[model samples]
Every structure is written in structure tokens, then in C-alpha cells.
Target: MPALLDIERGFAAALRTGDCTMAAELIAPAGVSAGDAITIYRNTFVSGAVKALKLSHPAVERLTGAEFFDSAASAFVAASPPSSGCLDDYGAEFAGFLRLYEPLLDLPYVAGVARVDWAVNLALHADDAKPLDPGEFDVAARIPPERLVLVPHPSLSLLRLYYPGDVIWRAVLERDESALAALELRGGPFFVLVWRNADGVQVGRVSEAGFAFLSALCAGRTFGESFDAAPSPELPVLLAECLAAGRFTDFREI
Candidate 1:
């Protein structure tokens, strides 16, 4: 029998190329013809990859139509197979891929929308934590500027797009709304923050300043330093609201 790694590599290559004959050469002889069984695997691989792509880029599919989206997914799968066993982690590079994809040129916002979808997925799968209590507010506030730190939820992600991509994403996902009428991209160069709050994962509009501020906090900047970087007069009020709303997720004192 072929070495396990060699067999796996050949099988993956065959799945990529639809080379059933090559795949058949590697399989153990069994009750069924190796070619037919290999074909099953090929189809299964395509289906799984396509499903991951669909989950990660649902907004793109909604924007482009399933037919076009499937084609793009297939092309992308053939070009770049999953490097990780965790299917949920697949398609991280899809946004970058769409940026250079010629067929999607007309839909400049597709990649950004895909990014939001991926972020939501990450948030859903992130580790759960107890939210900060009301009394901790004093502690969070009292931490000296230099000693303040933020422990962000694993699911939090910030996205900026040149189109109304987040709006488009919401319309597509919310079943109660008729998305077609609300599909126009507007208020461009949009910035958004997404995280699990008192409820489930929520997406909301944020200013560039807000995005930068949260990003800095998420990256471990102290309260004073992050505020210096953000430097917004209203930041105190917004920070309070975010904390009260369970938006901070976690933190540590420096």
C-alpha cells in the first residue's frame, strides 16, 4: 500500500482536478468499483467545500445569485483547498480572493460583505465568557490610564467597506425584511463593529474613530492610550454604553 501521506496527497489532487482515474489508482480494492467510490469522494469534497464557501460568503451569494456564487466557489476551491481541518476556519482568504476576481468587479462590496459574514461566524464560535458586572464599572473606570486593558470577546470583529455592505448583509439575513427594495449601496466608506451583546451577535454602524478606538482597545492598549488615539469627546459616553451593553467582553489591568 502507498504511504498514508502520499495517498492523501494524491486523493486531494484528484479531488481538485476531478481526476477520477488518478484517484482510483490509490484506493483499496473493495466491494464497489474504485472509480465509482472515488467519484463519490470527489463530489463529497466539492459539496463540503462549496458549503463552507456558502456559509462564509452568504451575502456574496445573495448579491451575485447562487449560480454565479457557486461558480466562484468552485473556482476558488480548485485553486485553494482548505489548509485546516476545521471547516469553520475555511474561506479566510476569500475576501482577498474576491478583490482580484474579475467577474466580481461590478460588485466591489462583495468582498467586504464576505468579511462581515466571516466575522459573525468567528463570533458565534468564540469562547464564551461572563460579562463584566455593574460594580466592575468603577474598576474599569478607575484603572489608571496606563494600567487599563481590554480583554475582547473572541467573536468581535471590525470591518470597513467603501459601500453599504453591512446594510446589504443585514437585509439579506433578516427574513422579516424585503431585501430587494433596500439593496442600494449608500453612506459609503462604512465602518462597522460586530459582537455578541446581551443578546446574540449584533452588527452596528460605527464611525472610523469608533472602529479605531475599539480596535486599539481590542489590541491591548490602555484606557488613556486608546483614548488618546481615539480622542473623541463623546468617547466616554459611548464607552459607558458599550460596557453597559456588554460590548467590552473582557479585560485585564496592566
Candidate 2:
């Protein structure tokens, strides 16, 4: 009989490739043949992953329809299995896969929609953090803007895309055909801001200036450096809104 490690490796390969030859060599057939058992294992494994993918990317599934989504997800599972043990950590690459997926090449916005789904899913699962208190903001207020570095809330993320992903995602989820119809698919690079609070996960579009300002802060830039990076005249109003939105957990003045 082969060693335990080698058998396990073979079993994993069989699960991925749908060939039981290596694992079958060691197994005696019972009521179910070794090949059949391996087949069951593979199907069960792939199906669970497909379901997880569907959950993480409901917009993608809704946009594509179950039949098509299942087929594409199955292919993705075969091509890219989960690396992390956590289900929440899976399917981060599905959006990229959809972009290159042959059948989806013409419908490129589908991938953008997947990105919105991924972003929102991530926000929903982010670690809990208290928003910066009004007092805290007041303390940081005394510091010169050049010396202030803001810590983003755990759930805040920026996803910039070539298509208006958030609009499409909302339109599809809400079944708002009029909004979808009015969308100019070619009018992109859209910047999407995703974050979570007591109200729940929020997804919305931000002007390029707002995205740049928030993006700079998220990257650990000081107010001065961030403004230099974005150089927007609306920087003051954007900063006030960021404070009101509770997008930060902390801040420090250097």
C-alpha cells in the first residue's frame, strides 16, 4: 500500500482532475466502485465550492443565470480551487476569471459586476471596529493636515473598474431595467466605495476626486500627501463627509 501522504496527494489530484487511477489503486471496491466513489467525492467537492462562489457572487450568478453561472463556476472551480480554508476567503479571483472566460469575453461588464459583488462581500465580512468618535476627530482636527494620517475602518475598500460595476450590480439586484437601460456602458472608469457600519454594508459610486482622496487615506497617506496625490478643490468637503461617514477607525498626528 502507498504511504498515507502519497495517497492523500493522489486523492487531491483525482478530485481536481476527475481521474481516480492513483487513489483507486489502494482502495478495494465495496458496494460502490472506487471510480464511482471518487466521482462522488469530486462532484461533492466542486458543488460545495460552486455554491460558495454563488453566495459570494450572487450578482454574477443573477446576471448570468444559474445554468450559465453554474457552468462557468464549475470551470472556475476546476481551474482555481480554494487556497484558504475559510469560505469567506474563497472566490476572490472569480471576477478576473470571468473577464478571461471565453464565453464571457463579449460581456466584459459581467466581470465588473462580479467585482462589486466581491467588494460588498468583503465589506460584510470585515472585522468589527468602532468608528472614529467625534471627540477623536476633534483631537485630530488640531493637527496640521500635513501631519495627519487616518486609519481606515476595517470594512472600507476601494474598487476602481473599467465599467460602472456598482450601477449594474444594483440595477440587476433590484430588477430595475430602466436604470440598466439608461447606463452608458462605455462611460467608465468608475470608482466604487464599499464599507460597513451599523446600518450594514454600503456600496456607492464616488467622484474621481472623492475616490482619490479616500484612496490616498486608505494607503496611509497624510492629508497633505493625499491631497497632493489627488489635488482636488473639493478636498475639504470630501474630508468632512469622510468624517461624517465613519470611514476611519483612528487617526494620528505626526
Candidate 3:
């Protein structure tokens, strides 16, 4: 019998390269020839990976069309491959791949959209916890910059894009809504926000300042520092709205 590592390596190669002969030798066989059975494995592998990619990048798939996106996703899988044991993490780098992918160079915003999608997926699976009560902030006249930590919800994802991908995403996703109409892709360097709530996936368009503010908090910056990075007359109001919207579910004084 082939060693487990060798068999696994050969299996990956055969699946990616479509060289079924080697793959056949590794798996258990029944009446079917090794090559024939290997084909089953290959098909299963590709289908599973592709489906996950589609789910993770629905907006990209919508914009690019199913066939193009599938082929590109297949090529991406063959190249970088997945390093994680979790299938959920399989397309973590897909955004980076789309950025360098030749056919997608014209669709620069697609990659940013992919990033947002992946973040949403991660956030949905994020740890469950009660969100902070907005009234808690009223108890403190001022939070110490060093000791204060703003907790953004684990499911909240902020994305910056060179095009209005968020707007496009909304139209494609909410097509069934009565309010949805024909959408023309906006020419933009836009920001997007995605978070999970009681209603499932929730997406919103945000300003560059909002993106910067949330992003800084995510990176562990103090509220004061994050606010300083993107100061605005309405920041206090904006922050309150985000909290009210469940952008951050909880906080701790770290």
C-alpha cells in the first residue's frame, strides 16, 4: 500500500492535473478499474470545490457568468490548492488569485467583491455572543484610549473596492425584491459592509471613512485612534448607528 502522504499527494496531483492513472492506484477499488473509479473521485472533488467557490463568491459568479467563473475557479484550484483541513477555508486566497488572473484583469472589482464574500462567510461562522448594549457607553464620560477596545461583531466585514461592487452585489442578490430595478454598475471606488443577522446575510454600502474606522477597530486600534484616522462631524452618530445595527455584538476593556 502507498504511504498515506504519498497517496494524498498523488491524489491531489491527479485530481488537479486530470492524470487519473496515479490517482486510481491510491484509492480502494471495487469491480471498476482504478482509472474509472478515480474519475469518480475527481468529479466529486471538483464539484465540491466549485460549489463552495460559487457560494463564497456569488457576486463574482453573477457578474462573470457561471461558465467563466467555474473555469477560472477550476484553474485557481489547480494552482494554489488548499492548505487547510477545512473546506470552508479553501477559497480564502481566491480574491488574490482573481486579482492576478489574466481573464479577470478587466474586472478588478471582482476580487474586492470576493474578499467581501469570504469575510462574510467567516463572520457567519464566527463565535456566538451577545452584542454590547449601546447604553453602556453612556455610563462612561470618556473611555481611556489605551484601555478601551471597541468590539465589532465577529460577523461584520468591511471591504474597499475600486468599483461599486457593493451596489452591483445588492442588485444581483436582491433581484426578487419589489424595490429592485435594473441596475447599472456604478463607476466607483466604493466601500462595502457585510454582516450576518437574524435575517441571514445583510449587506450595506458605506463611506471610505466608515470603512477606515471599522477596519482600524478590527485591527485592534483604540476607539480614539480609529476615530482620529477618519474624523467626521457625524462619526459619533455613525458609530452609534453601526452599533445599533449590530456591527459589533460585544466589547471588553483590554
Judging by TM-score against the true structure, name the best candidate: 2
Candidate 1's C-alpha runs over 4 A off are 27-34, 175-186
Instruction: Provide C-alpha RMSD values for all models, in order.
Output: 2.4, 1.3, 3.1
Q: Please estimate how well model 1 matches the true structure, expressed as its whole-model Cα lDDT.
A: 0.80
Tens-place lDDT per residue, model 1, 1-254, is 78899888888777789877877876779999887887788889888998998987777888789998888888888888898898888998888788778998887888888888888887777778776765677867777878989777666788888887777788777642667585667767888887886589888877777777888888888878888886888787778767776776666786
Q: Give the alpha carbon lDDT tens digit for every residue of 1-254 in model 3.
A: 77889988987788778888767766676788877777788888888888888888887888789999999999887887667767777798898999999998886777876787787777667667566677876643265766677777778778777766666566666664433355345666777888876666677876778778888988888877888888877777778887777777655566
* Count of clashing pairs, candidate 1: 3
lDDT: worst 10-residue window of model 2? 238-247
| Ordered list by TM-score, greatest first | 2, 1, 3
1 against 3, candidate with superior TM-score: 1
lDDT of 2 at 127: 95
Per-residue lDDT over 1-254 for candidate 2, one digit per residue giving the tens place of the 0 to 100 score: 67889888999999999988878887776999898988998999999999999999988899999999999999999999999888888999999999999999999899999999998889989999998875678888888989999999998989889988899899999999999999998878888888998899998777898888888889998988888886878887877776677778899987
Q: Point out the worst 10-residue segment of candidate 1 by lDDT.
A: 175-184
Per-model CA lDDT versus the true structure: 0.80, 0.89, 0.76
Candidate 3, residue 17: Cα displacement in angstroms equals 2.4
Clash pairs, model 3 backbone: 131-249, 132-249, 153-248
